[model samples]
Target chain A: MSEVVSALAGARASGMVELADAGATGMITLRGDHALLGAAVQAVLGLAMPEVRRVVAGEGAQVLWMSPDELLVITGYDVAPGLAADLQSALGDAFATVAVVSDARALIRLSGAQARDVLAKLCPVDFADFPVGALRRTRAAQVAAAVWRTSDSDWSLICFRSVAGYVWEALVTVAQPGGEVALYR
Target chain B: MLLLTCPCCGVTAEETEFANGGEAHLKRFGPGSDDADYEAYMFARKNPRGVHFERWRHIYGCGKWFLMARCTMTLEVFGTYRAQTSEPPAEIVAKIKARRPEWEGF
Candidate 1:
Protein backbone atom coordinates (compact mmCIF):
# COMPACT_ATOMS: atom_id res chain seq x y z
CA MET A 1 0.00 0.00 0.00
CA SER A 2 1.14 3.52 -0.75
CA GLU A 3 0.97 6.33 1.77
CA VAL A 4 -1.12 9.33 0.86
CA VAL A 5 0.64 12.64 0.34
CA SER A 6 -0.75 16.10 0.84
CA ALA A 7 -1.78 18.15 -2.19
CA LEU A 8 0.71 20.81 -1.18
CA ALA A 9 3.64 18.46 -0.53
CA GLY A 10 5.85 19.94 -3.22
CA ALA A 11 4.44 23.47 -3.09
CA ARG A 12 7.16 26.06 -3.12
CA ALA A 13 6.89 28.96 -0.70
CA SER A 14 6.94 32.39 -2.35
CA GLY A 15 8.70 34.08 0.63
CA MET A 16 5.98 36.70 0.60
CA VAL A 17 3.44 34.03 1.47
CA GLU A 18 4.00 30.65 3.08
CA LEU A 19 1.65 27.82 2.19
CA ALA A 20 1.33 24.69 4.23
CA ASP A 21 -1.03 21.75 4.31
CA ALA A 22 -2.88 21.78 7.59
CA GLY A 23 -2.37 18.02 7.87
CA ALA A 24 -5.22 15.77 8.93
CA THR A 25 -7.20 18.42 10.71
CA GLY A 26 -10.41 17.18 12.24
CA MET A 27 -13.61 18.76 10.98
CA ILE A 28 -17.12 18.28 12.32
CA THR A 29 -20.25 19.77 10.83
CA LEU A 30 -22.77 20.83 13.42
CA ARG A 31 -26.31 21.92 12.80
CA GLY A 32 -28.93 23.06 15.27
CA ASP A 33 -30.34 26.05 17.11
CA HIS A 34 -27.76 28.67 17.96
CA ALA A 35 -28.22 28.49 21.73
CA LEU A 36 -28.12 24.72 21.94
CA LEU A 37 -25.23 24.30 19.52
CA GLY A 38 -23.27 27.07 21.15
CA ALA A 39 -23.67 25.47 24.53
CA ALA A 40 -22.66 22.09 23.20
CA VAL A 41 -19.58 23.52 21.51
CA GLN A 42 -18.55 25.40 24.60
CA ALA A 43 -19.02 22.32 26.75
CA VAL A 44 -17.07 20.06 24.40
CA LEU A 45 -14.35 22.39 23.12
CA GLY A 46 -14.20 24.88 26.00
CA LEU A 47 -14.43 27.64 23.43
CA ALA A 48 -17.15 30.19 23.20
CA MET A 49 -19.38 29.93 20.19
CA PRO A 50 -18.22 32.52 17.74
CA GLU A 51 -20.55 35.26 16.54
CA VAL A 52 -21.86 35.15 13.01
CA ARG A 53 -19.04 35.00 10.47
CA ARG A 54 -16.48 34.69 13.23
CA VAL A 55 -14.20 32.04 14.74
CA VAL A 56 -13.24 31.24 18.30
CA ALA A 57 -10.09 29.34 19.21
CA GLY A 58 -9.72 27.18 22.24
CA GLU A 59 -6.72 25.27 23.57
CA GLY A 60 -6.75 22.71 20.77
CA ALA A 61 -9.83 23.50 18.81
CA GLN A 62 -11.42 26.23 16.72
CA VAL A 63 -15.10 26.80 16.19
CA LEU A 64 -16.24 28.59 13.07
CA TRP A 65 -19.73 29.94 12.71
CA MET A 66 -20.83 28.91 9.23
CA SER A 67 -24.40 30.12 9.43
CA PRO A 68 -27.22 30.90 11.77
CA ASP A 69 -27.64 27.26 12.73
CA GLU A 70 -24.44 25.67 11.43
CA LEU A 71 -20.88 25.52 12.73
CA LEU A 72 -17.67 23.83 11.68
CA VAL A 73 -15.51 22.57 14.52
CA ILE A 74 -11.84 22.08 13.73
CA THR A 75 -9.33 20.20 15.81
CA GLY A 76 -6.34 17.87 15.46
CA TYR A 77 -7.22 15.28 12.81
CA ASP A 78 -6.88 12.37 15.16
CA VAL A 79 -9.20 13.91 17.70
CA ALA A 80 -12.05 14.86 15.39
CA PRO A 81 -14.10 11.73 15.90
CA GLY A 82 -13.87 12.01 19.64
CA LEU A 83 -14.85 15.63 19.50
CA ALA A 84 -17.85 14.85 17.37
CA ALA A 85 -18.90 12.12 19.71
CA ASP A 86 -18.52 14.45 22.64
CA LEU A 87 -20.58 17.08 20.91
CA GLN A 88 -23.28 14.57 20.09
CA SER A 89 -23.51 13.48 23.70
CA ALA A 90 -23.53 17.07 24.82
CA LEU A 91 -26.41 17.98 22.56
CA GLY A 92 -28.37 14.75 22.65
CA ASP A 93 -31.98 15.30 21.56
CA ALA A 94 -31.42 19.01 21.44
CA PHE A 95 -32.46 19.54 17.84
CA ALA A 96 -28.89 19.24 16.74
CA THR A 97 -27.01 17.12 14.22
CA VAL A 98 -23.31 16.30 14.32
CA ALA A 99 -21.27 14.69 11.58
CA VAL A 100 -17.59 13.96 11.36
CA VAL A 101 -16.29 15.31 8.08
CA SER A 102 -12.54 15.27 8.50
CA ASP A 103 -11.94 13.31 5.32
CA ALA A 104 -14.49 15.27 3.34
CA ARG A 105 -12.36 18.40 3.18
CA ALA A 106 -8.77 19.61 2.92
CA LEU A 107 -7.24 22.52 4.83
CA ILE A 108 -4.41 24.85 3.87
CA ARG A 109 -2.70 27.52 5.89
CA LEU A 110 -1.41 30.75 4.36
CA SER A 111 0.79 33.10 6.31
CA GLY A 112 3.23 35.99 5.89
CA ALA A 113 2.97 39.60 4.89
CA GLN A 114 1.46 38.96 1.49
CA ALA A 115 -0.91 36.14 2.36
CA ARG A 116 -3.94 38.42 2.08
CA ASP A 117 -2.61 39.80 -1.16
CA VAL A 118 -2.37 36.32 -2.60
CA LEU A 119 -5.93 35.58 -1.48
CA ALA A 120 -7.25 38.83 -2.95
CA LYS A 121 -6.15 37.60 -6.36
CA LEU A 122 -8.81 34.88 -6.32
CA CYS A 123 -11.30 35.68 -3.58
CA PRO A 124 -13.64 38.65 -3.74
CA VAL A 125 -13.95 39.40 -0.03
CA ASP A 126 -12.24 42.59 1.13
CA PHE A 127 -9.64 41.41 3.61
CA ALA A 128 -9.24 44.89 5.01
CA ASP A 129 -12.54 44.58 6.88
CA PHE A 130 -11.88 40.94 7.76
CA PRO A 131 -10.28 41.29 11.15
CA VAL A 132 -8.66 38.44 13.00
CA GLY A 133 -11.20 35.77 13.97
CA ALA A 134 -13.37 36.68 10.99
CA LEU A 135 -14.52 33.63 9.07
CA ARG A 136 -16.10 33.65 5.65
CA ARG A 137 -17.46 30.95 3.37
CA THR A 138 -16.64 32.17 -0.13
CA ARG A 139 -15.14 31.04 -3.38
CA ALA A 140 -11.38 30.76 -3.63
CA ALA A 141 -10.65 30.93 -7.32
CA GLN A 142 -13.22 28.52 -8.72
CA VAL A 143 -13.71 26.30 -5.68
CA ALA A 144 -16.01 26.71 -2.73
CA ALA A 145 -13.97 27.52 0.35
CA ALA A 146 -14.10 28.66 3.95
CA VAL A 147 -11.47 31.14 5.07
CA TRP A 148 -10.66 32.07 8.66
CA ARG A 149 -8.22 34.66 9.77
CA THR A 150 -6.14 33.18 12.54
CA SER A 151 -3.79 36.10 13.08
CA ASP A 152 -2.60 39.35 11.60
CA SER A 153 -0.59 37.53 8.91
CA ASP A 154 -2.17 34.10 8.90
CA TRP A 155 -5.27 32.60 7.33
CA SER A 156 -6.65 29.08 7.10
CA LEU A 157 -8.68 28.01 4.08
CA ILE A 158 -10.66 24.83 3.62
CA CYS A 159 -12.07 23.31 0.46
CA PHE A 160 -13.63 20.01 -0.51
CA ARG A 161 -11.14 17.14 -0.82
CA SER A 162 -11.98 16.59 -4.48
CA VAL A 163 -10.76 20.08 -5.43
CA ALA A 164 -7.88 20.25 -2.97
CA GLY A 165 -5.30 19.92 -5.68
CA TYR A 166 -6.81 22.61 -7.84
CA VAL A 167 -7.20 25.01 -4.92
CA TRP A 168 -3.65 24.41 -3.76
CA GLU A 169 -2.25 25.04 -7.21
CA ALA A 170 -4.30 28.19 -7.58
CA LEU A 171 -3.10 29.55 -4.28
CA VAL A 172 0.52 28.65 -4.99
CA THR A 173 0.32 30.23 -8.39
CA VAL A 174 -1.00 33.49 -7.00
CA ALA A 175 1.29 33.39 -3.97
CA GLN A 176 4.37 33.49 -6.19
CA PRO A 177 6.52 36.58 -5.79
CA GLY A 178 5.26 39.53 -7.86
CA GLY A 179 2.29 37.44 -8.97
CA GLU A 180 -0.27 39.48 -7.08
CA VAL A 181 -1.10 43.07 -7.98
CA ALA A 182 -2.61 44.94 -5.07
CA LEU A 183 -5.71 46.52 -6.48
CA TYR A 184 -7.64 47.29 -3.32
CA ARG A 185 -4.85 48.07 -0.89
CA MET B 1 -22.47 43.43 -9.91
CA LEU B 2 -24.64 43.68 -6.81
CA LEU B 3 -23.11 43.22 -3.40
CA LEU B 4 -25.40 41.35 -1.03
CA THR B 5 -25.20 40.93 2.69
CA CYS B 6 -26.15 37.53 4.02
CA PRO B 7 -28.26 38.13 7.08
CA CYS B 8 -27.51 34.71 8.54
CA CYS B 9 -23.72 35.04 8.34
CA GLY B 10 -23.43 38.80 8.28
CA VAL B 11 -20.93 38.56 5.46
CA THR B 12 -21.31 41.14 2.74
CA ALA B 13 -19.95 39.60 -0.45
CA GLU B 14 -20.19 40.24 -4.16
CA GLU B 15 -22.95 38.87 -6.39
CA THR B 16 -20.78 35.90 -7.24
CA GLU B 17 -21.05 34.66 -3.68
CA PHE B 18 -24.82 34.50 -4.02
CA ALA B 19 -27.21 32.68 -6.34
CA ASN B 20 -30.37 34.53 -7.20
CA GLY B 21 -33.51 32.50 -6.54
CA GLY B 22 -35.66 35.09 -8.32
CA GLU B 23 -38.76 36.95 -7.05
CA ALA B 24 -39.56 36.17 -3.47
CA HIS B 25 -42.86 35.79 -1.56
CA LEU B 26 -44.52 33.82 -4.34
CA LYS B 27 -47.82 32.29 -3.36
CA ARG B 28 -48.07 28.72 -4.55
CA PHE B 29 -51.13 27.69 -6.57
CA GLY B 30 -51.55 24.00 -6.01
CA PRO B 31 -54.01 21.54 -7.55
CA GLY B 32 -57.66 22.60 -8.11
CA SER B 33 -56.70 26.22 -8.59
CA ASP B 34 -58.08 28.09 -11.66
CA ASP B 35 -55.99 28.13 -14.83
CA ALA B 36 -55.34 31.84 -14.59
CA ASP B 37 -54.29 31.57 -10.96
CA TYR B 38 -51.98 28.64 -11.69
CA GLU B 39 -50.54 30.40 -14.72
CA ALA B 40 -49.94 33.55 -12.73
CA TYR B 41 -48.31 31.58 -9.94
CA MET B 42 -46.12 29.70 -12.37
CA PHE B 43 -45.19 32.46 -14.80
CA ALA B 44 -46.31 35.86 -13.67
CA ARG B 45 -43.59 37.83 -11.91
CA LYS B 46 -43.69 41.48 -10.98
CA ASN B 47 -40.66 43.05 -12.63
CA PRO B 48 -41.23 46.44 -11.16
CA ARG B 49 -38.94 49.29 -12.08
CA GLY B 50 -38.62 50.49 -8.53
CA VAL B 51 -38.86 48.64 -5.20
CA HIS B 52 -38.48 44.87 -5.48
CA PHE B 53 -38.02 41.90 -3.22
CA GLU B 54 -35.78 39.01 -4.20
CA ARG B 55 -34.69 35.63 -2.99
CA TRP B 56 -30.96 35.10 -2.85
CA ARG B 57 -28.99 32.17 -1.55
CA HIS B 58 -25.58 32.62 -0.07
CA ILE B 59 -24.36 29.70 -2.09
CA TYR B 60 -20.66 30.23 -1.48
CA GLY B 61 -21.06 31.78 1.92
CA CYS B 62 -23.08 30.55 4.90
CA GLY B 63 -25.30 28.60 2.53
CA LYS B 64 -28.44 30.19 3.91
CA TRP B 65 -31.36 31.48 1.88
CA PHE B 66 -32.21 35.13 2.51
CA LEU B 67 -34.35 37.96 1.17
CA MET B 68 -33.17 41.29 -0.12
CA ALA B 69 -35.31 44.36 -0.72
CA ARG B 70 -33.87 46.85 -3.14
CA CYS B 71 -34.64 49.25 -5.95
CA THR B 72 -34.26 47.61 -9.32
CA MET B 73 -33.55 50.87 -11.10
CA THR B 74 -31.64 52.85 -8.50
CA LEU B 75 -29.79 49.79 -7.08
CA GLU B 76 -30.40 51.07 -3.57
CA VAL B 77 -30.66 48.12 -1.22
CA PHE B 78 -33.27 48.68 1.43
CA GLY B 79 -32.22 45.71 3.57
CA THR B 80 -31.81 41.95 3.83
CA TYR B 81 -33.81 39.59 5.99
CA ARG B 82 -34.01 35.94 6.89
CA ALA B 83 -35.88 33.64 4.53
CA GLN B 84 -37.73 31.79 7.27
CA THR B 85 -40.50 34.36 7.38
CA SER B 86 -43.48 34.13 5.07
CA GLU B 87 -43.32 37.84 4.15
CA PRO B 88 -41.09 40.83 4.43
CA PRO B 89 -40.82 42.30 7.88
CA ALA B 90 -42.76 45.45 8.72
CA GLU B 91 -39.63 47.43 9.49
CA ILE B 92 -38.19 46.66 6.07
CA VAL B 93 -41.42 47.62 4.36
CA ALA B 94 -41.50 50.87 6.28
CA LYS B 95 -37.88 51.55 5.38
CA ILE B 96 -38.67 51.11 1.71
CA LYS B 97 -41.75 53.29 1.95
CA ALA B 98 -39.71 55.97 3.65
CA ARG B 99 -37.17 55.89 0.83
CA ARG B 100 -39.70 55.61 -1.99
CA PRO B 101 -42.94 57.30 -0.91
CA GLU B 102 -44.92 55.92 -3.82
CA TRP B 103 -43.95 52.32 -2.97
CA GLU B 104 -46.73 49.88 -2.11
CA GLY B 105 -46.55 47.19 0.55
CA PHE B 106 -45.64 43.64 -0.43
Candidate 2:
Protein backbone atom coordinates (compact mmCIF):
# COMPACT_ATOMS: atom_id res chain seq x y z
CA MET A 1 0.00 0.00 0.00
CA SER A 2 1.29 3.47 -0.89
CA GLU A 3 1.85 5.73 2.10
CA VAL A 4 -0.89 8.33 2.15
CA VAL A 5 1.02 11.60 2.26
CA SER A 6 -0.70 14.94 2.54
CA ALA A 7 -0.02 17.63 -0.06
CA LEU A 8 2.23 19.35 2.40
CA ALA A 9 3.67 17.04 5.04
CA GLY A 10 1.89 18.70 7.95
CA ALA A 11 3.14 22.17 6.99
CA ARG A 12 2.67 24.82 9.66
CA ALA A 13 3.28 28.56 9.81
CA SER A 14 2.36 31.51 12.03
CA GLY A 15 2.28 35.10 10.92
CA MET A 16 -0.72 37.38 10.60
CA VAL A 17 -2.68 34.17 11.20
CA GLU A 18 -1.74 30.60 12.06
CA LEU A 19 -1.61 28.26 9.07
CA ALA A 20 -1.41 24.49 9.18
CA ASP A 21 -2.33 21.49 7.10
CA ALA A 22 -5.59 19.83 8.18
CA GLY A 23 -3.90 16.45 7.75
CA ALA A 24 -5.07 14.03 5.09
CA THR A 25 -8.77 14.69 5.53
CA GLY A 26 -11.51 12.75 3.80
CA MET A 27 -14.06 14.47 1.56
CA ILE A 28 -17.09 13.24 -0.37
CA THR A 29 -18.88 15.15 -3.10
CA LEU A 30 -22.54 14.11 -3.25
CA ARG A 31 -24.69 15.28 -6.13
CA GLY A 32 -28.31 14.12 -6.10
CA ASP A 33 -31.71 14.58 -4.47
CA HIS A 34 -31.72 15.54 -0.82
CA ALA A 35 -34.13 12.70 -0.04
CA LEU A 36 -31.25 10.28 -0.54
CA LEU A 37 -28.66 12.57 1.06
CA GLY A 38 -30.69 13.08 4.20
CA ALA A 39 -30.72 9.35 4.86
CA ALA A 40 -27.07 8.90 3.89
CA VAL A 41 -25.94 11.87 5.95
CA GLN A 42 -27.95 10.77 8.94
CA ALA A 43 -26.54 7.29 8.66
CA VAL A 44 -22.95 8.35 8.01
CA LEU A 45 -22.46 11.40 10.22
CA GLY A 46 -25.51 11.27 12.50
CA LEU A 47 -26.21 14.89 11.61
CA ALA A 48 -29.10 16.61 9.93
CA MET A 49 -28.84 17.97 6.42
CA PRO A 50 -27.43 21.49 6.33
CA GLU A 51 -29.29 24.37 4.74
CA VAL A 52 -27.95 26.14 1.64
CA ARG A 53 -24.45 27.64 2.16
CA ARG A 54 -24.44 26.35 5.73
CA VAL A 55 -22.10 23.77 7.27
CA VAL A 56 -23.09 21.31 9.94
CA ALA A 57 -20.05 20.33 11.98
CA GLY A 58 -20.21 17.49 14.48
CA GLU A 59 -17.41 15.87 16.43
CA GLY A 60 -14.90 14.92 13.74
CA ALA A 61 -17.21 15.30 10.75
CA GLN A 62 -18.87 18.11 8.81
CA VAL A 63 -21.63 18.19 6.21
CA LEU A 64 -21.52 21.29 4.01
CA TRP A 65 -24.16 22.45 1.54
CA MET A 66 -22.18 22.87 -1.69
CA SER A 67 -25.20 23.81 -3.78
CA PRO A 68 -28.93 23.24 -4.18
CA ASP A 69 -28.22 19.70 -5.37
CA GLU A 70 -24.69 19.14 -4.07
CA LEU A 71 -23.26 18.42 -0.64
CA LEU A 72 -19.63 17.98 0.46
CA VAL A 73 -19.04 15.57 3.30
CA ILE A 74 -15.78 16.00 5.24
CA THR A 75 -14.51 13.40 7.67
CA GLY A 76 -11.36 11.80 9.00
CA TYR A 77 -9.07 10.47 6.25
CA ASP A 78 -9.28 6.78 7.16
CA VAL A 79 -13.03 6.89 7.65
CA ALA A 80 -13.50 8.41 4.18
CA PRO A 81 -12.42 5.48 1.98
CA GLY A 82 -15.01 3.14 3.50
CA LEU A 83 -17.74 5.76 3.75
CA ALA A 84 -18.78 5.40 0.07
CA ALA A 85 -20.05 1.87 0.57
CA ASP A 86 -21.85 2.87 3.75
CA LEU A 87 -23.37 5.91 2.06
CA GLN A 88 -24.42 3.88 -1.02
CA SER A 89 -26.16 1.32 1.17
CA ALA A 90 -27.94 4.10 3.03
CA LEU A 91 -29.00 5.65 -0.29
CA GLY A 92 -30.67 2.31 -1.25
CA ASP A 93 -31.89 2.17 -4.87
CA ALA A 94 -32.15 5.95 -5.17
CA PHE A 95 -30.14 7.75 -7.87
CA ALA A 96 -27.18 9.90 -6.82
CA THR A 97 -23.49 10.51 -7.58
CA VAL A 98 -21.36 9.77 -4.57
CA ALA A 99 -17.61 10.26 -4.96
CA VAL A 100 -14.80 9.97 -2.45
CA VAL A 101 -12.78 13.07 -3.35
CA SER A 102 -10.52 13.30 -0.31
CA ASP A 103 -7.36 12.82 -2.31
CA ALA A 104 -8.47 15.38 -4.85
CA ARG A 105 -8.43 18.24 -2.34
CA ALA A 106 -6.33 19.74 0.41
CA LEU A 107 -7.50 21.22 3.71
CA ILE A 108 -5.76 24.00 5.62
CA ARG A 109 -6.56 25.69 8.89
CA LEU A 110 -6.16 29.39 9.71
CA SER A 111 -6.51 30.52 13.28
CA GLY A 112 -5.81 33.59 15.40
CA ALA A 113 -7.45 37.02 15.39
CA GLN A 114 -6.16 37.86 11.95
CA ALA A 115 -7.37 34.68 10.24
CA ARG A 116 -10.41 36.36 8.75
CA ASP A 117 -8.19 39.05 7.29
CA VAL A 118 -5.99 36.42 5.68
CA LEU A 119 -9.04 34.90 3.96
CA ALA A 120 -10.56 38.25 3.06
CA LYS A 121 -7.42 39.33 1.21
CA LEU A 122 -7.52 36.34 -1.12
CA CYS A 123 -11.28 35.72 -1.33
CA PRO A 124 -14.00 38.24 -2.17
CA VAL A 125 -16.37 37.43 0.67
CA ASP A 126 -17.92 39.71 3.28
CA PHE A 127 -15.99 38.50 6.26
CA ALA A 128 -17.22 41.24 8.57
CA ASP A 129 -20.71 39.73 8.70
CA PHE A 130 -19.60 36.12 8.17
CA PRO A 131 -20.86 34.11 11.12
CA VAL A 132 -19.57 30.81 12.42
CA GLY A 133 -20.75 27.69 10.54
CA ALA A 134 -21.49 29.65 7.38
CA LEU A 135 -19.78 28.08 4.37
CA ARG A 136 -18.48 30.32 1.62
CA ARG A 137 -17.30 28.67 -1.57
CA THR A 138 -15.49 31.36 -3.50
CA ARG A 139 -12.29 32.08 -5.40
CA ALA A 140 -9.18 32.21 -3.26
CA ALA A 141 -6.78 34.35 -5.27
CA GLN A 142 -6.74 32.56 -8.65
CA VAL A 143 -8.11 29.24 -7.39
CA ALA A 144 -11.48 28.06 -6.11
CA ALA A 145 -11.87 27.26 -2.43
CA ALA A 146 -14.49 26.29 0.16
CA VAL A 147 -14.14 28.17 3.44
CA TRP A 148 -15.92 27.92 6.79
CA ARG A 149 -15.45 29.23 10.29
CA THR A 150 -14.58 26.65 12.91
CA SER A 151 -14.73 29.29 15.63
CA ASP A 152 -14.80 33.06 16.07
CA SER A 153 -11.02 33.20 15.60
CA ASP A 154 -10.42 30.07 13.57
CA TRP A 155 -11.19 29.20 9.93
CA SER A 156 -10.92 26.16 7.68
CA LEU A 157 -10.24 26.25 3.93
CA ILE A 158 -10.24 23.52 1.29
CA CYS A 159 -8.82 23.85 -2.22
CA PHE A 160 -7.71 21.55 -5.03
CA ARG A 161 -4.84 19.25 -4.12
CA SER A 162 -2.95 20.26 -7.24
CA VAL A 163 -2.76 23.80 -5.92
CA ALA A 164 -2.03 22.89 -2.31
CA GLY A 165 1.58 24.06 -2.39
CA TYR A 166 0.64 27.34 -4.04
CA VAL A 167 -2.38 27.86 -1.77
CA TRP A 168 -0.34 27.13 1.33
CA GLU A 169 2.27 29.67 0.30
CA ALA A 170 -0.41 32.16 -0.68
CA LEU A 171 -2.07 31.87 2.71
CA VAL A 172 1.25 32.26 4.43
CA THR A 173 2.29 35.13 2.19
CA VAL A 174 -0.96 37.07 2.59
CA ALA A 175 -0.67 36.56 6.32
CA GLN A 176 2.76 38.12 6.59
CA PRO A 177 3.70 39.43 10.05
CA GLY A 178 3.16 43.11 9.26
CA GLY A 179 0.45 42.68 6.63
CA GLU A 180 -2.46 42.79 9.06
CA VAL A 181 -5.47 44.49 7.48
CA ALA A 182 -7.17 44.84 10.86
CA LEU A 183 -10.51 45.08 9.04
CA TYR A 184 -12.35 42.29 10.87
CA ARG A 185 -10.94 43.16 14.31
CA MET B 1 -19.61 45.21 -9.99
CA LEU B 2 -22.96 43.42 -10.41
CA LEU B 3 -24.25 41.63 -7.33
CA LEU B 4 -26.45 38.90 -8.75
CA THR B 5 -28.45 36.66 -6.42
CA CYS B 6 -28.53 32.91 -6.93
CA PRO B 7 -31.98 31.42 -6.34
CA CYS B 8 -30.48 28.00 -5.83
CA CYS B 9 -28.19 28.88 -2.91
CA GLY B 10 -29.60 32.38 -2.22
CA VAL B 11 -26.12 33.92 -2.15
CA THR B 12 -25.88 37.40 -3.68
CA ALA B 13 -22.25 37.80 -4.77
CA GLU B 14 -20.08 39.87 -7.07
CA GLU B 15 -20.07 39.31 -10.85
CA THR B 16 -16.62 37.78 -10.52
CA GLU B 17 -18.05 35.07 -8.29
CA PHE B 18 -20.56 34.04 -10.95
CA ALA B 19 -19.95 33.24 -14.60
CA ASN B 20 -22.06 34.74 -17.39
CA GLY B 21 -23.15 31.90 -19.73
CA GLY B 22 -24.65 33.98 -22.58
CA GLU B 23 -28.44 34.07 -23.29
CA ALA B 24 -30.91 31.94 -21.34
CA HIS B 25 -34.11 29.99 -22.18
CA LEU B 26 -32.74 28.61 -25.44
CA LYS B 27 -34.85 25.83 -26.97
CA ARG B 28 -32.21 23.27 -27.87
CA PHE B 29 -32.72 21.74 -31.31
CA GLY B 30 -32.22 18.04 -31.86
CA PRO B 31 -31.56 15.81 -34.88
CA GLY B 32 -35.22 15.82 -35.90
CA SER B 33 -35.47 19.63 -35.61
CA ASP B 34 -35.64 21.68 -38.82
CA ASP B 35 -32.58 23.56 -40.11
CA ALA B 36 -34.17 26.95 -39.35
CA ASP B 37 -34.86 25.93 -35.77
CA TYR B 38 -31.28 24.67 -35.40
CA GLU B 39 -29.87 27.88 -36.88
CA ALA B 40 -31.92 30.03 -34.49
CA TYR B 41 -30.80 27.96 -31.54
CA MET B 42 -27.19 28.07 -32.62
CA PHE B 43 -26.69 31.70 -33.65
CA ALA B 44 -29.74 33.78 -32.77
CA ARG B 45 -29.45 35.58 -29.45
CA LYS B 46 -31.33 38.45 -27.88
CA ASN B 47 -29.33 41.64 -27.45
CA PRO B 48 -32.12 43.93 -26.25
CA ARG B 49 -31.10 47.24 -24.74
CA GLY B 50 -33.91 47.21 -22.18
CA VAL B 51 -34.62 43.72 -20.80
CA HIS B 52 -32.34 40.72 -21.24
CA PHE B 53 -32.37 37.14 -20.05
CA GLU B 54 -29.11 35.33 -19.36
CA ARG B 55 -27.71 32.11 -18.02
CA TRP B 56 -25.22 32.43 -15.17
CA ARG B 57 -23.35 29.77 -13.26
CA HIS B 58 -22.62 30.49 -9.64
CA ILE B 59 -19.21 29.03 -10.30
CA TYR B 60 -17.53 29.99 -7.05
CA GLY B 61 -20.49 29.59 -4.76
CA CYS B 62 -23.17 26.90 -5.09
CA GLY B 63 -21.96 25.71 -8.52
CA LYS B 64 -25.53 25.82 -9.87
CA TRP B 65 -26.75 27.30 -13.14
CA PHE B 66 -29.55 29.92 -12.94
CA LEU B 67 -31.38 32.40 -15.14
CA MET B 68 -31.34 36.16 -14.60
CA ALA B 69 -33.69 38.82 -15.92
CA ARG B 70 -32.10 42.24 -16.11
CA CYS B 71 -31.86 45.47 -18.08
CA THR B 72 -29.01 45.48 -20.59
CA MET B 73 -28.82 49.29 -20.55
CA THR B 74 -29.19 50.09 -16.85
CA LEU B 75 -27.62 46.84 -15.62
CA GLU B 76 -30.49 46.59 -13.15
CA VAL B 77 -31.36 43.03 -12.30
CA PHE B 78 -35.03 42.07 -12.20
CA GLY B 79 -34.84 38.58 -10.73
CA THR B 80 -33.05 35.22 -10.80
CA TYR B 81 -34.53 31.73 -10.95
CA ARG B 82 -33.46 28.12 -11.15
CA ALA B 83 -32.10 26.82 -14.46
CA GLN B 84 -34.71 24.03 -14.58
CA THR B 85 -37.42 26.64 -15.24
CA SER B 86 -38.29 26.74 -18.93
CA GLU B 87 -39.52 30.33 -18.88
CA PRO B 88 -39.49 33.40 -16.70
CA PRO B 89 -41.94 33.14 -13.85
CA ALA B 90 -45.09 35.30 -14.02
CA GLU B 91 -44.01 37.72 -11.27
CA ILE B 92 -40.64 38.48 -12.89
CA VAL B 93 -42.17 38.85 -16.33
CA ALA B 94 -44.72 41.23 -14.90
CA LYS B 95 -42.00 43.20 -13.15
CA ILE B 96 -40.06 43.71 -16.40
CA LYS B 97 -43.22 44.60 -18.26
CA ALA B 98 -44.17 47.20 -15.67
CA ARG B 99 -40.70 48.79 -15.65
CA ARG B 100 -40.02 48.71 -19.37
CA PRO B 101 -43.33 48.91 -21.21
CA GLU B 102 -41.67 48.71 -24.68
CA TRP B 103 -39.81 45.49 -24.03
CA GLU B 104 -40.63 42.59 -26.43
CA GLY B 105 -42.11 39.49 -24.82
CA PHE B 106 -39.79 36.52 -24.03
Task: Give a tens-digit lDDT track for model 2, residues A1-185.
Answer: 89999898899998987899988889888889987897789987799999778899888889998877888989988988688778877887788988999899999999998888899899988898888999989999988899999799989999999999999999989998989778887
Per-residue error (Å), model 2, residue A20 = 0.6
TM-score of each: 0.91, 0.94
lDDT for B9 (candidate 2):
83
Give candidate 2 regions above 4 Å deviation: none
The residue-by-residue lDDT of candidate 1 on A36-130, one tens digit each, is 99899888888887887889998888899888889998888778889899999999888889999887888899988777888888899888787
Indicate which candidate wins on TM-score.
Answer: 2
Query: Model 2 in CAPRI terms: which quality?
Result: medium
- CAPRI docking class of candidate 1: medium
Question: lDDT tens digits, residues B1-106, model 2?
Answer: 7889888888778899999999999889988899999999999887877888999999988788899999888899988988888999999999999988887788
For residue A129, model 1's alpha carbon misses the true position, in angstroms, by 2.1
* Clashing pairs in model 2, backbone N/Cα/C closer than 3 A: none
Whole-model lDDT per candidate = 0.86, 0.88
The runs of at least 3 residues in candidate 1 whose Cα sits more than 4 Å from the true structure, single-residue gaps closed, are A1-12, A180-185
| Fnat for the candidates in order | 0.83, 0.79
